[model samples]
Target chain A: DTAVSQTPKYLVTQMGNDKSIKCEQNLGHDTMYWYKQDSKKFLKIMFSYNNKELIINETVPNRFSPKSPDKAHLNLHINSLELGDSAVYFCASSQWGGGAGMETQYFGPGTRLLVL
Target chain B: EDQVTQSPEALRLQEGESSSLNCSYTVSGLRGLFWYRQDPGKGPEFLFTLYSAGEEKEKERLKATLTKKESFLHITAPKPEDSATYLCAVCGTSGSRLTFGEGTQLTVNP
Candidate 1:
């Protein structure tokens, strides 16, 4: 079974369109995160939710929003997506309360988003 | 600013060749250093975690060693299948957020 999974592995839409990507984790982890990998393969953090509580929010654009319904799911919604928004999105989960050594983050397969 | 730098953006080697990738970091109060292997079109897969300086971890033909300033991932007698992008990330003591490097792309030819 996959520990972390994301819906709609590939998304292709026109510019100015709105879209959402869903992520779910079955590892019973307390923390979930969203990352965006740009064309240069630079992975950067966008948001993080711990036990349904917002913990870390990077300097992402206000157009991007992340919502966590519970500890097991985190969804990202983008408003008026732009051409520059094209990138691969990744979902990851980890046991926050566990010690640093024991709480290695596990990542999902990633969702490729293309805004033309 | 906290950052992680990886050397040799890309490397090509013959099968059975040995090499090492470097990851240097500048973070406050290091919690753990992580090594991950990623194939194209896939998320990174965790390989090892180094909690402190002088820590080492090994699996198969890969071995990871950590120092106060940097970390090294050594590949011994690598095969074609061992080729992939190796990423290094640092989990800070605060917030447990990971800062990732640009990653080193490795290719092994049979």
Candidate 2:
């Protein structure tokens, strides 16, 4: 079974168009995250949700919003996307706790987004 | 601010050749260090996590070790299938987010 999955493996839209990417994890993890990987292959965390609670919000612009309906699903919605929004968006999940090896994250295949 | 820097942006090795990748980091309070392998057109796959200095973990032909300021991933007798971009990340005590390094791309030829 696919532990973590994402929808719309590829997305190409206009400069002003809005788009959303869906992510789901069946690992029964308590924390889910959204990450952006730029063309340089630098991965950065954008947002994180633990049990449906917003926990981590990076320096990302307000155009990017992450919503977690439950523990298993986290979705990202971008409003009025621009050319700079082109990158690979990845969704990850992990069971967070105060112990060793508890925070290991598993990532989904990723959504390749390109804004013209 | 927490940061991670990986060395040798890219490496090419013949099959059965051994080498190591480096990940240097600076964080407020270290929580854990992670190693992952990413193949072309795919997300990163988790490999190992090192919680503290002097810690070591191994699997198959890969072994990871951590120290006070950096970590190393050693590959022994690597096969062509072991070729991928290796990523290093660190999670500090200040937040639940992970700071990742620009990965080191490894190319192993048969």
Candidate 3:
């Protein structure tokens, strides 16, 4: 079974279109995260949710909003996609404990988005 | 601000060649250091985690060692299948987020 999974492995749309990406984890983790990998292969954290509560929000654009319906699912909605928003989006999950930072995170296959 | 920098950016090795990748980080309070291997068109797979200085972990041909200022992923006798972009990340006590490096693209030629 896949520990983590994301739908729409590839996305291509106009610059002004709205889009969303879905993620789910069967690992029974308490925390989920979203990260973006740019063309240079630099991975950066975008958002984190713990038990459906927002925990970490990086300096991402306001157009990018993350929602956690339950501990197992986290969805990202973009209001107005831009060319700069085109990147590989990865979903991750970890079992949060005393120190959540020390936990090992498992990642999904990633969603490739390309905005023209 | 927490920052991570990976050296060499890219590396090339022949089959059976051994090498090490460096990841330097600066954070307020170090919580853990993690190593992940990512293949093209796939998500990163967890390899090891080093919680403190002098901590070391190993898996097959990969061995990760951590220090106060940096961490190293040493691959011994690497094979073509071992080729991938190795990412280094750190979790500082300041927050529940991880700061990742630019990643090192390792190519092992057979």
DockQ of candidates 1 onward, in order? 0.60, 0.59, 0.80
Candidate 1, B15-46: lDDT as tens digits: 99999999999988888899999999899999
lDDT of each: 0.92, 0.93, 0.93
Error of 1 at B27 (Å): 1.2
True contacts kept of each: 0.60, 0.62, 0.87
| Candidate 1 lDDT tens digits, A4-100 | 9999899999999999999999999999999999987899889888899988789989999999999999999999999999999999999886534
| Candidate numbers, best DockQ first, in rank order | 3, 1, 2
State the lDDT at B54 in candidate 1.
Answer: 93
Superposed on the true interface residues, model 3 gives a C-alpha RMSD in angstroms of 1.3
Better of 1 and 2 by DockQ: 1
**What would the per-residue lDDT of candidate 3 be over residues A50-115, giving only the tens digit for each residue?**
999998898999999999999999999998899999999999999987546678889999999999
Top-DockQ structure, candidate number? 3
Off by over 4 Å in 2: A98-102
The TM-scores, one per candidate, come to: 0.95, 0.96, 0.97
Q: List the residue pairs that clash in candidate 1.
A: none
TM-score of the second chain, each candidate in turn, equals 0.97, 0.98, 0.98
- Worst 10-residue lDDT window, candidate 1 chain B: B90-99
